[model samples]
Every structure is written in C-alpha cells, then in structure tokens.
Target chain A: MPTKTVAGTTVEVNDEGFFTDPSQWTEEMAPELAEAEGIDTLTDPHWTVIRFMRQEFEEKGTGPTVRALGKTSGVTVKELYQLFPKGPAKIAARVAGIPKPRGCI
Target chain B: MTHRIVILGAGTGGTLAANRLRREYSTDEATITVVDQDDVHVYQPGLLFVPFALARPDDIVRPRQDQLHDHIEYIQSPIEAVEPDADRVHLTDGTVLDFDVLVVATGAALLPEETEGLTGPGWGEKVHTFYTLEGATALRDSLAAFDGGRLVINVVDMPIKCPVAPLEFAFLADWFFTDRKMRDSVDITYVTPLDAAFTKPVAAKRLGGMLAERGIDLVTEFNTGEVDGEGGRLVSYDEREVPFDVAVVIPLHGGQPYVGRSPGLGDALDFVPTDPHTLQSQSRPNVFALGDATNVPASKAGSVTHFEGDVLVENVSRFIAGEELDASYDGHANCFIETGFGKAMLIDFNYDTEPLPGHFPSKVGMPLLKESRANHLGKLMFQWFYWHALLPGRDIPGIGPDMPTTGKRSPESESP
Candidate 1:
C-alpha cells in the first residue's frame, strides 16, 4: 500500500485500490485516478479535461455533456470521445475519483 | 595468396563492405567472404512507415545474398563464436574460417522480452511495434480496424535503430486516420522516457512543437515499468499510468546473439565499445566494427552507417597496407524526418555541431533543420538512392561520407 499526493489531493492506494485520503470529492483527485489507471504522464490538455469534469461534478454534482466537456477542454466531441470511449461523463468522473452521477448509467 | 577478408553478418554493413571491397580489390588481390544466418535482408528504415501503409513489405526486403557482387563468397550459416586470438570464426557447423582481416557487422536485434510485462497478453492484440517486419504488418491490421480510441506510440528506451521513427509514427498516424476519416476518432499520444521529443534539445523542441500543433499528446519522462494489458494501461516506475486502447511500443534493442557468444565482445547492452572516431574495436586492432554494432555517439540510422562505411573502408584498407589508421571519424550523422501531411525535416550534425538552420549539401540545396515539402520529396526519393546509388557501392555525386559542415549554420550564430 502506497499513500501519495497527486495533483494537490492526498490519495491512498493499497492492494485493493485507490481512494481519497481526505475523502473529499474534488478536481485534484484526477491525478490519483490517472495514477491508478496507469496514466502518470499528463499534459495540460489531460489536466484541462480532468479539472473540468471535477468542476462539473462539484457544480451540478453530475457529469457534464460530451459537447460541454469538449468545449471546456478545447477538444472536439469526437476527440473527447476518442480519449474517453464511454464518454467524458464516465472517464472524467472515474479519473476525478468522483462517484458515478445519478441518471447516467 | 590473396588477402582473405572474412565479414560477419551479411546485412547492410556486411553486404556493402563486401561489395565496396570487391570493387576496390581484384579477385586475385583480395577474396571477400560474407557470413550470416539468414539471407533475408530487410530494408529496416521502411519498416517504420509500414504500419501506416506507406510502404509494402516486399518494397523494403530483398535477398541478402543477391545484393553482393558475384566474386564475393556469401556463406549462409550461423556464427557460433569468434576466436580473436586464433584470428578465426567458428560457425554452427563447426567450420573454422581463418582470415587475415575480419569485419564484424552483426547488427542489432529487438528484445521485447527485456521489458517486464511488455510481451504479455496484450501483445499482438493491442500492443505492437513497427520495428520488425511481422510487428509492422500486424500493427497495420490493428490500425485499419481500430474505429476510435487512444493510440499511444511509446519508445521503451533509447539507442533505437532510428531515433526519429517513433515521432514519424505519431505523425503518420495523424495522416493515416485523416485518410480513413477517423482522425477525429483517434486520440494519438507520443510517450518517451526522454525529456523531449528527440535526443537533441533543439530538434526536440521543434518536433515537440510539431506534436502539439498536430494535436498529439507528448508525454515525456515516463519510464515504462509494467504493462497491464488486460487493463489497457502502461504503468511507470513512479506508479504513473498512461492508458491506451492500442499501444505501439518500440522495445529495448541489443546487439546480435553472436556478440554475447564472443567473449569480451560487447557491453551489457550487447553493443561493441569502439573508438568513436576510428571505428576500431577497443579489444583488438585486427578486428573492426561498424553500423548498429558499435556504441558510437550517433543515431543508429542508415546515413550514419553510410558515413561510417566510408571511414571504415578507408581505415580497413589502410590497416591492411601496413599504414597508420587515421582516427578521423567525426561522428557525423544526418537524417530526413518524415513529418506527415506531405512534409519532412532534414537535420545534419556532427559530434561538436548540433542540427542548425541552413541548407544542406551546400547553400543552394535542400532545406536544413527545417521541415519543407521538398525535404519530404527528398525523403521519398532516398529509397531509390539507397538501392541504386548507396548500397551497390556507387557513390553519390556530391555527398561525401563525412558531414559537410561548411553550409550548415551554427547553433549560436543564427542566420537571418
């Protein structure tokens, strides 16, 4: 088990899986989720989409539309869809370590 | 008695040396013999573009024995080991070939197994490399069928055959998807352990900028630790992860197996340590090395081999004639980077000089240190030059083995 800080979030990862150290639903948790997913290398674009997803989760407590996510991240809907096959709602939410939104199965 | 010259590994360097030496020395004066395990000599540079459908396999491969001249004896056999003290070579069949002069050109090999978990369940399914003929062909099918997802081009380590190849793959991917109308569907990423897109900082900055402009994600300083294929992830040592739908990995490379068999022949990486300037093996004066086998401070590209071949041919001839070997190889290297969208960049430099801005082969010729349509044409035209002029021992009209430093601009002294 390794406890580390990722993108300003304190995360704990043991033999089971990764979780928030403070257990707060925030944008900074994206790096930790990225780390858990084997995505240590993050460009500004990667962080942009990640941070946007977190903000959307915080504001509405739900994942944003793929178009809105792409607009915020300077990517096309297709491009965003390419990065996140299940859509920005699923990937961004997962990467931000936020719980899956309601009505978005 | 004729000068019995024994050449090992009848690939690029071996075949070229044998043919060049044959032209230089008559049959009565010197007898040339080339030894290798297989006769299938691959045009390695073409392998890079194969995955993108830019080149066909047949276009890049040819019979190894057919490339050499008629007088030269091409022995198709695996080398068991080399007895440096006895000035002899032991073949797998137990035949010992004694020679007055020996040339070891047993080039490098791809070792995908060297990287932990690289050859796991994900291999051939989602993970592939274009470095080998089969790997490139496999990737072609994978790329064609991939509707949309993360396509990562990762270079596991450095000292690869062609340093610019991975970048080329990224560039070509952009073009490949664009042609298929799926450019928007695929998210391309270029990952490397280096701090930049290239080894040289200037070229790195330039190429990195190009990667950015092309919407390709550049992930530097990510040393691949383990590949979790089932999970579609690449985990680094620091527990950083880069997930991919399809991962194109250029695995760690090493010198030929024969190098390890020959005691004190190679370093841990299986590369022979030689005087960079002289191209003479550090172990023995009678033995010489060239191409990817030597640990020369240059890109392991064909141009470097062509340049080194000139100096090596001269040095070998000098050594045979009882003359002092001139240690004058300048570590010259030149490469034409194929940046997709019908464009390419040309860079020429030596040990002391970095790739600077200006014209190449003289101020009146091709663009240097800059990408241009003309340079792209030059790159495409090189395949013909490689076969007709370069390989068959026929010299190019103006270009010499040593890099021409005159017309190239200095890094510090910027030209307007």
Candidate 2:
C-alpha cells in the first residue's frame, strides 16, 4: 500500500507506481503518470486515444483492443506505437484512468 | 596420439554433436568423451505440455547414456571448473580430462533467485513454472486444485529455450480450461517484459491477434522486479502489478556455472562468445560453442541446435584437419507453435528474414505463418523426429544449415 505523490497529489500505488485503484483517478493526475512512463507531454493525439479508450471502457466495461482502437480511433498500429512506445493500450488505459486492459501486450 | 574431442553437457546440443562427431571420425582417428552432471536428458520442449497433461513427465526424460553412441565415452560427474588455457576440464571427483578440441554445449539454466521473492514463500504452492520436468510435474498437481480466478504466466526475462513455449502454455491453458468447462470462471493473463507478444513484429502481430481472440490477457513491458508470491502479485520496476491466483513463470536463464569458472571462455552471462556464423569460440580456434550455450542471437531452441549441429560438426572436422574453418551456420531455425484446439502455426526464418507466409521447406509442404491442424500434427510428430532423426545426427534430404526462400512469400508482395 505504498503511495506516490503524483502532480502534487498523493495516490495509492503498488511498488512499481501504477495507481492501486482507478476510481481515485482524476484528470489532473495524467500528466504525472504520463511523465513516469517516459512521455514528456501529452499531445492532442495522446488525448484522442486516451479519452476514446476511457469512454469505451466506461460504456462497454472494457477497453478497446489494439486492433479495434487502430481501426476506430483513426490511429494505425504504427501511429499508436509512436504515441505510446512500449504498450499503447496498457499505458493509454492507465493514463485515461482505467484498470489495466486485457490483451494489452 | 588419439585426438580427444571433449564435449561438456549431454543434452540436445551435446548429445547430437557427439553422435555427429563420431560419424565424421573413426574410433582409431579420434576419441570422444561426453560429460554431464547426471544421466537425465529431458526433451525440454515437451515440458511445455506437461502441465496441461498433454505429455507425461516419464515420457519426456530419457537417460543421457541411452541417447549417445556406444563409441562415445560417458562421464557422470559434476563440473568443478573448466581450464580453457590448459585445455582441461575438472570434475568434482578429482578427474581432469584433457582435450585437443572442446565443444561447450552446456546450455542456459534457470535463475529463479535473480528475481526477488520468486523462490520464497508459496513458491511450490501457488507459484509454478513448466520449464523443467520437476516444475511441470509439480504444476500438474497444483493446476488440478485451481478451480478458477486469475492464472498468470509471466516470462521473467528473454533468451529462454523454445521462446514460444510460454505463449503455447497460455494458449494450451485456454484450451485446458475450456475443455474442463471452467473457461468462464478462469481468467488467464500473459505478462511479459517485452512490448509485443513475441520478438519479431510480423509474428508478434499474428500471435497477439490470436491471444485477443482467445480472451487471454497480455500485460506488456512489465519488467518484474519482484514476485510477491504470498500476496499473489507480480510487481514490476515501473510499479505496475498483475495479481494472480496461480502463477506460471519463466525465470531468467543463464549459462551453466562452469562457464563462469573458465575465464575468457564466455561472456558475463557465461554464454560463450562465438563467431555467430562460424560457431567457433572467439577465444580459441580449438574451442567451439553452439546452441543456447553461445550468445548467437539465434533462437535458443533445439531446432537451432539441430541446424547448428549440422555446421558445427563440419567445423570441428575442419579444425582437426588444420584447415580454415567454414562459417556455415546461418542462424537458421524453425518451430511449430501450438495454438491449441488441435491447431498450430509454423514459422521458418534465419538472421536476415522475418517469418514469411506460404509453404515451408518445400513449395507444397506445411503452411507457414498461419494456424492449421497440419502444424499441430507436425509439432506432435517432432518428438518422434527428435529422438529418431535429429539426435541420431542423420541429415534429412532437402534440409541443411542455411534457410531456403523458394516457398515463402516476400513481405512487400502482399496486399496491405
């Protein structure tokens, strides 16, 4: 039950720093989380995917698959990789304030 | 003087290399000796199916002496040290064998202690791995008790033997649960340190899609710093955690301990630094390494060992004859990926080409880069081929060390 101070707000995190609970997520908290994943700033494209993923999770109880996101979010698999290098779905779901998505690898 | 070619380890690489070398030289011309810690020779790939009950533990392992040629002398003793400079290997029982040529095929070993808390409390209970005969056998018992909940398979690091085995385990787990009618209650997740589902992009995309279709979860780029087995959590350095009810892990792999005992003979990880193409040890002309024992960028698979053994045997012959060594190994390797439900996919490639779609080995042979029951049968048939054809060092017609491009489609030619 470790806590990390993200964007001047302390949040419960595991040993690695991912938020323990997504319900406690706030819009202002993304900048801190994104920075830790090695992104300098969240741009329009990043927000487009992030917001789209969050909305999809809220409505469907699950986030979009990478293939689904690429087709619907106007981002190609290559472009999504550029936006989120290591793993887009997992990182975007985290930045968008959702629990880790299934099949994100 | 009878030339001595001492080979360390009597597993896939060592066993086959010993047999192949025996074929090249007569008993009067050269003497061969194979040394191992024990008589056990486990078909490592078969361990992948043991937990799923697809394979019996007793069926996978055979005596090392049974697989080797009678002409080859076998030594059962622990390796204390290897003196590369003096051209001798020290055994724990105080026997030192000198060699004119040496093949260091003692392959990579699992290092569970490298990751924090992996071997601690609940290690044999909740946390299990199918990488060894004992682990796979133990997992079979542990899995029977698992009614449901999160079953996580984590690859602690890369460069493991039969790299696709973990994914196959996940795919087979999906099949196992569905067959048991508990598929709904069970949640299977694959956590890897890599970004993609696999190493190569083309294959990763295909495998990733299969994972999505099967409802198996994938957690990527998770550099696990610790395994909280008691708490049932895999905590990564990035602070991301994947909770688990039953855990199957692929621990970090490293070369055998004797590699560390010999200076300038191996890399920091104890993997011998070889001319990747030649399979010759970078340190000395008389010394050579192949299979998982070498830092060869090639897949640390038995198929790679099979193909490498083709070139390695020839190189050993040339070395003994005082001729310029040939760099014949192309890093050529092929594998059948079990995707479950009586279906599998095959991939064939070398250092240059990624896995391409079409027929393999021949124009009308099994399909590549796609799943079919034929590949599954081919995967099953490989066990027979391994013991009978591969380990006996008999070269199959139309197959060699270098990769063939006749039957595969070039990536650019496809419609995107």
Candidate 3:
C-alpha cells in the first residue's frame, strides 16, 4: 500500500491509486481526485452522478452499478458515458471518494 | 535438387499453408520447411474460454510438429532475420535456410509494454489479460477470488485476433456469475477504442444492443494511453480513466519481430503488405502472407486466414507455372459469437458486406447474426473441425473464399 498526497492531504491508496480506506475521504477532495483521474471540470451533471454515487455508497455500503445508475439517476447510458467516459460507476465512485466499486464488468 | 518452400510460422495460418502446399507439390518436386520458435500450438480462440474454465489451457495446445504434414520439415528455432532478396532466412542459431518461395505466416504478438503503465506494479496481481496462456490462467484465479465488483474487458485497439472475443468474454462472464447466482454482484463493461461495439456500423448496432440487453455497459472510442495496474485504472490520453477490480485486456498487437528484422518485407507495423485480393506480398511476387501477419483490412481471424489459404495456394501454383495469379479472395471472414445461455450467433461477411441477419451458406442454413443453440454447438464443434478439416487443408463443402450474398438480407430491405 502507498499514500498519495492530494490537495495538501495524504491518504492511503493501493498501487492503482484507489483509496485504501473510504473513511478518510472528504467531499472537497473529489475534484482533485477527479482531476488526477482525467476529468478536467466537474459540471452540474458530473456532480449529480458523483453526489448520487456518494449518497448510494453511504446508504448501501457500495457504489451503484452502471445499470442501477442509468435506470435510477435519470442519466441515460449514452449521457453517462458522455459525462464519465472511463465508465460511469467506476469514475463516479472514484470522484465520490469511494473505493472502486466491486463487480464492474 | 528439390524446390524449397519456407513458411515462417507454425500457427494456424502457417500450418494450413504448409499442409496445402505439400499436397499441391510432390515430395520430389518441393521440400517444405516450417520454422518457428517453439512447438506449442495454441488454439487461440480457445483462450477466451479459459477465464471461465469452459476450456483448460492444456487442452487448447498441442505440438506444432504434430499439425504439419510429414513431408514438411519442422525447424524448431527462432528467426533472427529474413532476407527475401536472397530467398534466405537467418535463424538465431546462425543457420541460413534458403527457399524458392517464402510464406510469412508468423502471426502478430501482443505488445502490452507499448502502452505505458500496463505492465507496471499490480500487473499480474490486479490487471490481467486472457490473450496469453499465463494471462488467461492467472485471470481464472483472479475471477475465482473476485467476490463481486467491476470486471472490465478492455480492447486496447482493433485488428486483434478474433475481434469479437472481448464481447464474448463479457457475455460469458454474465453467464458465469449468473450460474453462481452472483450475477447481481458483478458489473461487466466492454471498453474499446472503436466508436461502436464493433467495427462495422450495422454489426456494431446489433452487438451494442446485445451489450445493453445483457446489462453490460459499453464504453467506446476509448484510446487507452496507460494502465495503472497498481491502481486498477486505465488512463486515456484524452484524460478519461476506467477503474476496475480486475481488468481483462487484449493488449496492443503488432507483427512478429522477425518481420521487422527483414528489410522491405513489412509495413511500419511489421505486417507484410499483401495485395488484398491475391494475398501476394507487395515486397516480392514470390512472397505471400496471410492471417495476422498481413496488413490487409480484413478481420485478423482464423476464418479469414482459412479463406486466404485457398486462394494463396492457387496463386502459388499459378506463380510456379508462370501463369497469372487468381484474384478470387474477397476477404471472406466468418465468426461465431458465443452469447451465453448455451446460444451463439454466427456472422458471415466479406470486404464489402457487413454481417447481415439471415441464414448463412444456404437459405435454410443456421441463423446468422442471431443467437441459437445450434450456433453454440457449431462453435464448440469448430475445435474438432480446426484440427481435422481446416488445418489439414481439406475443403469443407459450400464454404469458399467468396462470401455468398444469396441468403443474406440487406439492411434496407430488413428494416423496410
């Protein structure tokens, strides 16, 4: 395990840069994390998915899968891909300060 | 003095060509020599089944020498360089072999190192690929330990062997998890460099729709620049990143190293440029290439190579007779896409045709571009056909180098 300093704060991360512990994540740290992951600006639509993923992770203990988000988040698959091209659930979970969601196909 | 014929690879393409050429020329007329680095002949299409344990790695491989004709001499040595001008090939052992006709069938190799961070930390631990034996075997373990999470199958670029394999993996993974009653726990995504799920627009739509129907997310137009294996993320130059618990990748592919070692023999990517129709190398008239070794626009599939072998052998016969080469090959490529649930979809197409929905070979034949139990069995039966009929160069009836358009439905007609 390695620790990466982002936004003047250090957090435990795995070799793939995924957060080792979700407890240390902060709402303000997402933009910097997103920037490092390739999203330049967090638009309203981007935040909508990010916030939804974070809320879902808090409530359910796991980020929503792409199918669940596409159906419930009011974001179509095409729109979600446009919003987060790396993949909706994977990137949104990262920006939401959650561990990379398990069971991503 | 015997006429020497040298084929540079022992994969499906080279093995079929060696057998076909031997049948065409008598033992006294021509002595065929096949050179390769090793004796293990992998059933590449079978590699897709390994991660799911549908097929074992050991079952998919055999000795390369066992596949060739007895008359064809097998040289177990690495090719250091190829000198087409002198009709000679230099092996790593410093043995120079001469040939009257040379066939470059030394198919492509996966180059994961070409992409930055792919083979970095957590490579074999987190990021895995099924394109190789070790990669596939490792992924089986990774998949077993995977309780649930995102499993991404990423195709680094197109022109990969059996272009539909990644999609098949996604489909099969769906079945595997569902069988374990854990399909709900896994998230499957197919990420590719193409804008659509597949290359051809019509086929892409159908395939893309299949992904949607199966609950598999489709991420297209993704040109991966790096794989943060340690972080389990794929970073693109465009600044998009795909993260996963386990990544099954079909890494970037390029022609064999020896192809580049030879001057004026291959294109920039080491793929020998061949006339799309004649399958004869542009570098030399007597030189020919097929399969993944050629810089042709056709799909780099075993079926494509099988069709090319038919026309190539004829052209080789015509060349020796000083006659005009036959231009019969029309990029015929057929593929069976396994769609899980004991069903598969077959597609028959060529250079000018996209895969159309209809019965293939005949009007009442097995359904094409549509899944059926028969198609699944056909796919399973192909392994038997590959070793018995295909590699032996025996022609199966109704199948040829030209794509038959008789029973196929045109997109416009089908819609209207």
Best by TM-score: 2
Off by over 4 Å in 3: A1-105
Give the alpha carbon lDDT tens digit for every residue of B144-202 in model 3. 88899989989886568888998999999999999989999999989997768988877
Q: Which stretches of candidate 2 lie over 4 Å from their true place?
A: A1-105
- Residue pairs with backbone atoms closer than 3 Å in model 2 (clashes): A16-B238, A16-B239, A17-B239
Label model 3 with its docking quality class.
Answer: incorrect
lDDT by residue for model 2 over A2-97, one digit each (tens)? 877777877776654555676677888888789878888999999899889878878755776554576578876557877887667777876876
Q: Cα deviation of B398 in candidate 1 (Å)?
A: 2.2
Cα lDDT of model 1 by residue, B266-340, tens digit? 754667877888888876787889888887778788887888888788888998898998888887888888888
**Structural similarity to truth (TM-score) of each candidate:** 0.79, 0.81, 0.80
Better of 1 and 2 by lDDT: 2
Per-model CA lDDT versus the true structure: 0.79, 0.86, 0.86
RMSD of 1: 15.0
Superposition error at B315 for model 2 (Å):
0.6
Q: Please report, as a value between 0 and 1, the fraction of native contacts recovered by candidate 3.
A: 0.00
> Residue B171 deviation, candidate 3, in Å?
0.5
lDDT of 3 at B129: 89
- Write one digit per residue (lDDT tens) for candidate 3, span A1-75: 899887788998877667778888887898898887788988898888988887877875677666457656877
What RMSD does each model have against the real structure? 15.0, 12.7, 14.9
**Candidate 1 C-alpha lDDT tens digits along A3-44:** 666677556644334233325545555666666665676667
